[model samples]
Target chain A: MNYPNGKKGSLTQPSQSRPSGAGNHAFSNRGMTLEEDINETNRFYLDTDKAIIHKKPTPVQIVKVNYPKRSAAVITEAYFKQASTTDYNGVYRSKHIDFEAKETKNKTLFPLANIHNHQVAHMRSVVEHGGICFLLIRFTLYQETYFLPAEKLFQHWDDKLKGGRKSISYDQICQEGHQIPFQYQARIDYLAIIDKLYF
Target chain B: MNYPNGKKGSLTQPSQSRPSGAGNHAFSNRGMTLEEDINETNRFYLDTDKAIIHKKPTPVQIVKVNYPKRSAAVITEAYFKQASTTDYNGVYRSKHIDFEAKETKNKTLFPLANIHNHQVAHMRSVVEHGGICFLLIRFTLYQETYFLPAEKLFQHWDDKLKGGRKSISYDQICQEGHQIPFQYQARIDYLAIIDKLYF
Candidate 1:
């Protein structure tokens, strides 16, 4: 099965040891999740000595911990904290790369509320400091991902603040953002787009 | 008082918070930890817009969450996850900067165990890719900090693999690493050293 993002899903007969592929599991259509695909691509990049990028783990504030014998120290009480920056950032070719990856099922427009105010401020700082910053938006319904630079995002964000549309239309994204290629191992292949725009 | 690199002894008092005639909490002389000082310095840099550097939040693997009515979701179970990279990373002058900070009470030698194998590997990758990478080591007893470059650290790490010394002597570090100056608001002025050395 070929997904809209160009991800190929493999079909195989059910192995008796594995649970029957049905119900909730059906949502995963064999093609990896966008985050999973990006992770794999990053791993491939790391292994081949190309670029160093990592998904910043979700931030959580731990309150209570239990040290059980013969087991690891387990955190019992915690709370998710709003992240001050984006989900992923690292260095590629001596340049700082900062970005947020968000997937939306809606196909018409990517909502501005999907991003946080502090994140916008951080991306602005990165750009002002001469680092490369952008947003990786995946339209799940369409299975297409686009890389929107921080400058363009700032413009749209400011426009929304000025009582404009709170979301950017799909057509505008198609015209302004760089479409990331979908490959097998390199999945998102965002760096390929970077090679064109940045290099 | 000052503690070891493992970050024990956090139970000192606020009585020492005020140093004599300093008009503030300057007993940082005996009480403030190196990490706290670095954090303050990073805050100062951010406020001044000199450079953008941040400590990545501690990674926690969330197991369960509770979404109560009309409030934020609360994480109920989680575990601290081993970080895959260095503690601090960001861009300085359009150059990628990555580093790990550790303080030791041991005045003569800084043990190799203070650093993890993966962290060393990650720093090596950063250096190989032309990004600036180093270890910020503080000798708590002497109130001294040194920036040990990744290249020098890799040499010592490789020597350990060859059955050499597992620790680098303070004298050796004093010769190889750049001594970072302590400042008032910019507590650990490592970037000042970067301005001198890299620039």
Candidate 2:
């Protein structure tokens, strides 16, 4: 299928050496982190009146603060706390959208260790309460990002608890998950998958 | 109307002396801050499978970190960042829920300075996107908490920008907002108001 940005060739040939052209601009984004791309895409969605989503700030446990006479208070000692919920959440078309994003350089499989048990429980509760939840898994090696519904993730998660495979193979993900098209503005374009699966 | 948890008398008689009875236990919670009360209420909501809401972590800008050998990375230089969105957001009854909570010791008015311009803008966008948005205002002196819809807040917020009153009068809030009933488990029972207004 034709990708949204019409740069299908570049997506498939992620590592190919090509002459500097219009597509080179999109290739510059390759160095950007998944979080950066999603943040940019969320901004585009907000500016276009398509969605209201945001990444929650990193959880930090502040221990000490120093107040200078003529400056803002500075945190002197703090530690990072594990997030209990997913990274991104918001409203789209009157529905609550909740999801966590992860990029794996592994070409063979996506490790289950990347996700925490509490987050899986939280996602289950969100689904039970009638909210839309999913995971954005990006295979960095192939430049492929897949939108995996939370329900599909739960199956793999539950299997691991019962001594099944600790990771999901690349072939399994491609079969079970929807591939998110690359777009110039909306780099991740996961919402496009949402529109098809939900709306 | 009779309030939930059968503590209506305690809610109205904030300063009245009462015999140390079963109700006194509930009154002990008076010393808790609005944030503490809301956190407890949210925990109750989660435990009962009533809703899925969480307070976003405080936004912090980390500038320096020290990686001590065999120890967690310690943040050495960080500063608080202004939050662009509301504090609490999640889903309830198949609808997106978003809100900010504040407590005012002022008996007459809730100062508009307590809320930032960008936060007001964020609330407006949430409403436009079909989310259930509101404000949880607590009058500490009166021991009363009110759920103010974003629509009513916008009226006063816009008026303030146009050189009107810089604060919302307590009386006006009582007229335009729904008083959340004080409960034992759900300290600030805001969801009860949501059920009436949105469900």
Candidate 3:
């Protein structure tokens, strides 16, 4: 399929050769970050009229700005601020879709430290309000992305709070999460899983 | 009512007195900008479990950064980028809510120049996807905030494209739009109109 932008093969392929074995199987889309994959997928969804999701801009606290006479305003001093909500959110099939994409290099388990408390609270609010909330987690070692519902994530988060396992094992993820099938255009075809779960 | 953060009366009342006339009646919530009022209203909505809406962060293109040892990374150079979507969006009563807020100081008409072409396109996509979309316009001179539905906005937008009036008259806004009632907590109580119109 023809991609809208000419960034077709550049983002999906790895730049350098990797050692063979199980790692070789993860070569497809090796260099692309989970954020890039999801952004591409969201763009595809928008282009196809399938969804209207978008990644919110990175939050920043602007301290100073300089407006040149003939030029655009330049922000000279700023700092990154912790986001109060997830990275991506929008409407899909008349439902509000909210999710955070995370990637871990570990193959055995996904660490809970990647997520913050406020994000969990935000996800809970979304779920309570009848919106579709979840996590798009990519295990880089296997190049396998999984869709874990917010409800399922809350269980592990609560357990972590109660001094339980700090991470969800790969086996547990395999059991609880649905593997997102990678495609040429929609690299992370998450809506396919959403259709089955929600629709 | 007690406003959170103790910013109660500070933002609502003007710092100085105004001469008695049509302009005098606009003193309520005079100093606060449209953005500030809506943000305060959204915070109230969130606190009351009424809605889960939030304004997207201002999009910025970071060009340079300095990583000081044992200190937060400082963005040394950046420029504001145009947003691809509306300012505020979230879920309310199981329905996706998306909107852009604009303010006009002119008493007779609101210039269409405040909104961009891409924002209108984003609103159209939101509406086509069955999400509730609208514009919150604040007439600062009259202290009136109106909720103009996306469907109504498109007619005016298309007219502008066809070499029609570049601004929507105040009378037209009064006729086609619903005036949002100002409240103590929910400064720009827009959902009141949404409940009547959509729910």
Candidate 4:
């Protein structure tokens, strides 16, 4: 869990977190992190047939396979593949949905670099085609998650390229984003924002 | 490439013909066959700045790694993680483009079983939200590809569940799908249809 030479536990630290269940060790205090909570919420959504959202699977490339005696073939060599789309996407109330989820511990700001250029591009397309695209930013320090529309994020991202701030300030996020509440069942309560914005 | 199942020019065949640049061995074509072609098309899209689509990375649960003589660490033990989203996605003309690319040698129809329930559910969301969602089905035997929208595909899928035909006939596909031309550059010129339909 020790990251070398950088201020650890900042807003973007979760990027260093293991992408799957194993990453839980990094956030021992929180028990289940924001992803797990949202996953549970998504499951509830599916079970109830209210809305269908899912976190995309991680991509891998298998290089070698081993066929042991009288057993199923085993994959021996594989490498990770770059993802082309956002992490989460699905349907809600007959609408197409697409988005990415990010968590940061920094109390004051969220780094724009945490998002890849392609993801920004993907979100832009989602919005253009009439899909609701946004980022679920979790300020772990404040235990707060905000749904920031992609349009706003993209403007700030382009501005940064033209000598603006590297990150979006917490104040701006507070002003623009819908603050998502935490619940035991639907931990992120993102659907509340979705309902308000799209419905 | 001849498969043991009497199929010709199959990507799944270890003895299939390969283009010049790829590695020259049986080990190279070990993973999903269509994945590389789609990725190359995506790369072309990005390089040309035509669209910003990408295939999601594979999800792996890395259980163990071996450091052998300062080379790339060899992954010794791992398990595949289930995917929550479709394979390919991006933006075209400021719209969200998301889809799964599947190839079947069979010329008659596409099997609903090849696609998972979860993926269908995810596509449903894209349609609901107004995103251009579809399935790129390649009839390898016919050297033809079709872009079937989520709505059209889902209808047949629903009928299948109700004890209808297990597959969609090529005649039905011709009626429902928009033909995608295979250019040497883009490979599949799907956006043209998108332009005609959505624009």
Candidate 5:
């Protein structure tokens, strides 16, 4: 029972009547995006009152605008911009949980460049402050998602300074990170890993 | 020197060569919004590595777009969207900080309606999870600001259900909340109050 891309967490009973294509298998919910799955899962969390998490909307810089008569303002110019913070953050079991989700079709290694500098510093700041922070990396080809703690990430991030590997091998992720279970309703059920580690 | 609205936290040499309109006296910054003051102060914090805070961009739902040849796509239609979370949130001194900034020209009372139901719920959730949550309220006419704790706000919010007053008097806020002093550079030096209370 999946609604369209925009109708998320509608503060009421999940409405069933939407577009025709409602189901996606594995990672295919009508060309379902990983972000879509996570958003839906977060909605599920909100519905059951399990936890409150939100994906910060993509930041856009609106430059020019026109006020059409008797209509909403039309953005004549705008550009998608870089986000300073991680995509997802919220509270679970009265503890702060923050993480970034990334996916790569490449099967062997997860490129370190996929993460931004400010985002890394942000994650570090969170963890140092006693908040739970991690990286949710998904391999699209393999359909596998791993939760890599910020501490482990910092170690690899620092290695680049010493002329180390530019990316983390998939094998390293499997060994150091926990696999995130994929549920039909909760596409990226990251809380499972959070519960095990934090609790 | 203030950069244009879009060029925020550009991580380089503070770029002092922007527009010159630095000092603001008692919340008077030559057509500057409260948001601008906080943003500048946050940049001061970021450049000196004092703290990391950001005003979450206003969420907008872009409905239509026009892509011309060899250039960025231009958003043609969009509507300002409601925020599911607060406008400002960040990590300071290793603790989670969340708040919503609001201003009212009314001198007598701060209306509860200004604070949304979901936002109030969000703040409560943050506090229940042991994070610091509060509201930064500005009395525009008086050029006075106060940091109203989420707990105190919740008391008033719930009172509405119990047939209590719909707004908090300016005097009540002054007594219950911490007055945020207006400064030259750090306009709303809220972190000062936070340091005294939380740290």
Candidate 6:
């Protein structure tokens, strides 16, 4: 919807409007989703023995499958399952790392609704367990990303419940979150922030 | 499909023959599969403040979707894209953690085929990055799971290509891989192994 700064596509628009069988065929993802960039970065880290990180498989509830003669089984029936944890996680230098990567067209504020209840709880556990926990928020329109700690997220979440704001203003994020730099090698360059914040 | 111990289920068995729609869906976990378990463990860690780990979402190439109503959109056409990294990843205690999980009915040996070519490359990258990387191997029949390091997996994989064994014997896994105990609190007691191995 209307991002705090009057930027980005409304969630209702992209998520709701769809052509028939639009999702069944594979789309090229010409523009990278946040997940892809992070995955590429993780690969670079792994290739150089720098870090190890991977995106977990989508949680799917398969209802049926089609077995075509001597071929990899095809999932004919399935539904998305609610995720129980953040999107990305791993270990670095013997320390636990956890985070969720999200993209928003909004140039100003990030919506809390984009963060799920279970995910919030999951991040809480990471912080409690002494792990580095945060969210990689991307302003797709601005092509900028910020790392927001779960604590700040919780604080804003409670604030939202009290009807203070619908989203985290860009100014608030810039004030509270660390801006992540982009590099050809690491792509997302998140570990740099981790080095500064957690290490 | 024949497991190492002599149990066999036709790999050719129709994927649809398994009618997994109903039953103990909570723990039943039909398609959520092994990755879901890892994600759940990550959530538990986030909630309890133990360790932080997560599996990335499936990189689906969604080409077609059907929207019968404004409120519902169903993916009608999609294809699996090749993944460049391992499935599960994150950080623990500031140290990067990365891995993949697989389940097999075979009792004798885990097939190298189960581990893909690209994934092997991904694991190698993690090793290069100075991060902890491994695989969670589950024997569904015996209900046994093992955490096998990528190094060992790589070695076996290479050996197989050179005309050695087609799989790693379970006995060998028991010797080289860390046995992941099943705990009521955290279904897969992987963090315990992390504590023992890295901490």
Best by lDDT: 2
DockQ of every candidate: 0.64, 0.78, 0.82, 0.24, 0.40, 0.27
By DockQ, the better pick of 1 and 6 is 1
- Per-prediction interface RMSD in Å: 1.1, 0.6, 0.5, 4.2, 2.3, 3.7
Query: Against the unseen true structure, what C-alpha lDDT does each candidate score?
Result: 0.79, 0.85, 0.85, 0.71, 0.75, 0.69
TM-score of chain B of 3: 0.86
DockQ value of candidate 2: 0.78
Q: Show model 3 residue runs off by greater than 4 Å.
A: A1-30, B1-30
Tens digits of per-residue lDDT, candidate 3, B1-199, equal 2333323232244432122244555544345667888999999999999899999999999999999999999999999999999999999999999999988877799899988999999999999998999999888655678999999889999999999988899999989999876666788789998999998
User: Residue A142 in model 5: shift from native, Å?
Assistant: 1.4
**In model 6, which regions exceed 4 Å deviation?**
A1-49, A55-58, A70-74, A91-94, A140-143, A181-188, B1-59, B81-84, B87-97, B101-107, B127-131, B138-147, B161-163, B178-191
Residue A110 in model 2: lDDT? 98
Ordered from best to worst lDDT, the candidate numbers read 2, 3, 1, 5, 4, 6
Extract clashing residue pairs from model 2: none
Which tens-of-lDDT digit does each residue in A5-110 have in candidate 3? 3232322434311223445646433456677779889999999999999999999999999999999999999999999999999999999999999988776999
Models 1 onward score TM values of 0.87, 0.89, 0.88, 0.69, 0.81, 0.67
Which residue pairs of candidate 1 clash? none
DockQ of 4: 0.24
- A174 in model 3: Cα distance from truth in Å? 0.8
How would you encode candidate 1's per-residue C-alpha lDDT over A2-48 as one tens digit per residue?
A: 33455422233221011223333544555455687689889988988
Q: Pick the candidate with the highest TM-score.
A: 2
First chain of candidate 2, TM-score: 0.88
Q: What digit string (tens of lDDT, one per residue) describes model 4 on residues B1-199? A: 1123323333444444332234454544532345555776677876776776767666667766677786766676676666666877666775667899887766587887888887887787677655679988877655466889889989988998899988888888889998775455555667778888888
Please say which candidate is ahead in TM-score: 1 or 5.
1
Fraction of the reference Cα-Cα interface contacts (below 8 Å) that each candidate reproduces? 0.71, 0.91, 0.86, 0.34, 0.44, 0.40
Show pairs that collide, candidate 3.
none
Q: CA shift at B58, candidate 1, in angstroms?
A: 1.0
